[model samples]
Target chain A: MPETILQTRALSVERGRQSIGLPDLTLHAGGTLALCGPSGSGKTSLLLALAGLVRPRAGEVIIDGQPLWRLPEAGRARLRGRAIGFVFADYRLIDSLSVMDNLQIARASAHLARDLDRATNLLERLGVAPLASIRADRLSQGQMQRVALARALMNRPALLLADEPTAALDEAAGDRLIDLLLDLGRDEGIATVIATHERRLLPRLDDTLFLALPAEAVA
Target chain B: MIRLRFVLQGLLRRWGSTCLTIGVGALSIAGLCLIFWAQSAIPEAVKTRISETDMVVGPKSSGLDLALCCALQMTPAQGLLELERVQARLAMDDVRPFVRMQVPVAMGDSYRGHRIVWTTPDIAPFYGARLTDGRTWRQPLEIVAGSEAARSLKLKPGVRLTSSHGLAADGDAHDAAYTVTGILAPTGGVLDHLLLADLASIARVHDHGGEHDHTETAPHSRVNAVLVRFTSEIAQASLPVLISDSETLSAASPRLELAKLMALARPLIDGATIVSAIFGALAVMILGLSLMQGLNRRARDFMLLRFLGMSRRDLALLSIGESLLITHLALLGGCILAVAGQSVLAGMLASHGLTVSGAVPFREALTLYSAAVVLSVLSALGPTLRMSIARDDEELRA
Candidate 1:
């Protein structure tokens, strides 16, 4: 219904001798995709390649109508910094910094004018506004995850790539996190792909791409 | 460009290691400054004290001992130059032809632990001594106190003090009363610690006891040394040798003796410089290692920064900037400590018989601080290189 914001064509990312292949898929504005697989299923490798962090061995990933692999490393980096946001399993927040500073880090690095108003709005939406002055190290895991999600939106990125973002949370927190991500995606018209082993999150996302384990261990 | 607040927080996060690194660097810088201060201050004080006088002729003794006694007043003259010998040198065809003026100094007497230097009236103007309170001494048993002597002993122009037999505080007291006629301004010279009297007055003060046994005989009287000013440059090269060759007396060029003293002290100065350099190198190494360790410890954070679009080059610069912060702070702290310590040292040395004056050597200070900064930057190479090549994706997992 909306414009296609992300797509992949015969994309295969190599890890050691094995490769992870993604079905030719298209995600439009406000669409959500879940990448589900067991450990060592190359889910992270495919995610990295799509995010321009890993070079694809074959095929291509296209984001916002531009072929990602065709760009040079610095160009790809610039695109990722401006157009893509990453959320890691552990939140990966700088412990020494306050939540407010952590959220503005990427914006500052990209030379984008820091919009404290946007940061405050996102933190309040995430229900972590009161913790903005607290150090990241002092926040609970759920609070840190919320802060990390706020940081991912600091630059108002068009695409968010989350890797096992809910793996460390309890079920109730995990359910809230997934709902919040979907809600944010819909409200902001941002495309999102979540990579997770959590089977419970499967029904919530708009689409699912299951990465099968290599044949050697399927038995 | 790195964010100053972020960099500061990065360092503060590891404040224990950071403070240790800073402590080592600060002490090293302080050591370097002290060595530089000593290398410059000792010679400067000597040169300043002897700037006016051209030559010092004293009894036959080590040239250093004579220079110390006659020029610096740091040591007493071992033996005396007979008044006849002094007069003979003044009249000699070889020495007299070049001499413009000579002031004979008589010692071996003290007033309240201050050495009484009995010399001709010319000694006052030679040392640039100005009367701070009263007039110059004009007669026997009358004295002019140096500024330090006046202040420490609380003596005014009209205060009467008796001379002791020798320089020691416990030396036998002479019954003859010496009147304080004037107090000299602080000249920042050996003269600051001396009580001044005319040669005739010293003779009269010592004449009271059997000590008169010698001053009573004028031509046979002994003067410790002679302070000489030559009319021409030729006198400096010829007169000292001509007088030193005499069996009864020794002559020393104040400038030449000062040069020799510096030459003798060169090894100690060199040793201090070497020690300070080693300390500086050691500090750099220690600081560099700590920085490297910090980089390793913060690999995860650095990777996160990379993910945030911080380039490899920026990370490297961040590493260097952190080192610069630590180094400059340490250097500033060390320099402040050194100046404070030096001032305290100056006061302490005064009581122990050394006179150091003026400010710390600023040029040397600037040079040392610049070198330390350069060293700090250079020491960052290891950590920066590691940062430049680090794989954020790999390091974050580790």
Candidate 2:
């Protein structure tokens, strides 16, 4: 009723020669979901499929009421750029550029105008306003993780795909990032799907999809 | 929609390798340009200098030296030949019909390392030299600077520079302050660099103060060389031997001696061509390897970009654009180096009896630029492809 932001019906992600079938699931606006799995359990792959980055082998993926992979390549790319955001565990920021430029690149990738006020507000919220002029490579790991989170939210996407976004941070820092992510998702009506193994953060999310490791992936 | 700044930022992220590749590329491009320029220009300058003159008649001397000294104005004359006596000898029964025009040149003094040719004003039209500035020299102390000579020596119509005693720059400075009365337009030949003066100028410089010897016509003065035009090919074949039979006069065909000179330099030219090809290949390899060496880091960056919702095409463009920026930077540096290097090369060659035209080879440069770009694209193809295809879940991270 709140309008599904991310939905999958019998979706199976194509992982090279193998395909892993997924259960039917739906997440409404402002909701968060956890994808719990061991290493190589296709969590990252499922996130990729849901974000329209990779083709699903079967069934359907719907983001914001539009069928993913049914649109033309450019249209799909446009949708992904405008409607999706991604975060990395390693905080992938171009090391040479300043923190502000990293956010500008995110806005540029979506063909969006440089909203300086919005970027400044986000950096201030992340407590990184003083670090905006610093190069990404010079930042501490916690600072880098915050700056990366700011870049992810730069485009104000409808859905967020994060691959262990807080894996590299300390427990307290990770807790702070998870709190900021869930609070921002609720305030902005953004649906978030996180691929992570940390159990402490699962209770804060609205739903969880536990992907059991296939036999071939265990050993 | 990904900005070029982002593309360039990624390049500067690895500035050390970027600068190295560009440095090598610039040097290679400059070397290639110089080789091509010298290969084409030297023979061209020689051919144009000897285009009209059939034979060089000077005092008994080496044909190579005579051609280089008399026609190209490369060196000072070894000895002087009597002009009146040579004309008298040409007026013989069988030789008079074969002879055409005769222009005498007396060379000895120099100004700022530039040769001073003391001949009549008739020598101006003979070498196709036209005045671009003030009039031809009317008095012994007045002189006309060639186009290059004026530019290099900074001579204008009113500028006064002293001439030296010999062709070398170290010669005794003359007390006579020579006035630059005119400047010659560029002929792209030897005349573009020579200082043309009248016979009286040499007579004054040599202190041969007979006043009659100051005239522009047959002044009964000895000249360093006589440029001869023959009416028929038969004379060209037999006249140099006939003239050389005399004890004091020697004849050398300008075309024949220049051929021998080129044939002698052919091996060096071939060797330069081979070395340039190798250097060019190596430069391209360094460029490719520079890109290849950074692939892992660049691929990770590109993976981040792709994940950040940058489209596949934008990702590919970002990758290719990175290499193109390096290439464009190299081109700018190479062009500056080539321009500076060519002038230095010209000066070095001039020191040893050769002259080069100062003209930009625009078409050849354009060809080289296009070739360089094509090579750059080819060299970057694999890396760009790898960047676009990089993935966190598949190839790169996993």
Model 2 C-alpha lDDT per residue in residues B1-398, reported as the tens digit of each score: 33777666656767788888788888878777887788788778678877778888888899888988888777657777788878887888767788777788888778878888888887777777799889999988888988988888888998888887777888777667788899999877778778888887764565535532322223328888888888897887788888888888888898888898889988998887678667667767877777776666666776666666667777666656767778888888887888898889887877754677655478887888898888888778877677566554664364
**Candidate 1, TM-score vs. the true structure?**
0.87
Instruction: Please list the residue runs of candidate 2 whose C-alpha ends up more than 4 Å from where it truly belongs after superposition.
Output: A14-19, A71-75, A206-219, B1-9, B43-52, B92-95, B111-121, B128-164, B169-221, B230-248, B349-357, B388-392
Per-prediction TM-score, please? Answer: 0.87, 0.83
Stretches of candidate 1 off by over 4 Å are A1-12, A19-29, A58-82, A104-108, A111-116, A207-219, B1-16, B110-114, B128-134, B145-189, B207-220, B352-354, B358-363
Worst 10 residues of 2 chain B by lDDT: B211-220
The DockQ of each candidate is: 0.46, 0.51
- Scored by TM-score, the top model is 1
lDDT of 1: 0.80
Note the residue pairs that clash in candidate 1.
none
Give one digit per residue, the lDDT tens place, for model 2 in A84-202. Answer: 98888888898878899899888887778888888899899989999988989999998998898889888898998888988998899999999888888888888888888787777
Worst 10 residues of 1 chain B by lDDT: B211-220
* TM-score evaluated only on chain B, model 1: 0.89
Q: Using DockQ, give the best candidate's number.
A: 2
TM-score of 2: 0.83
Residue pairs in collision within model 2: none
For residues B61-140, write the lDDT of model 1, one tens digit per residue: 87777777777776665777677678787787877878887778877778767888877778887777789899997787
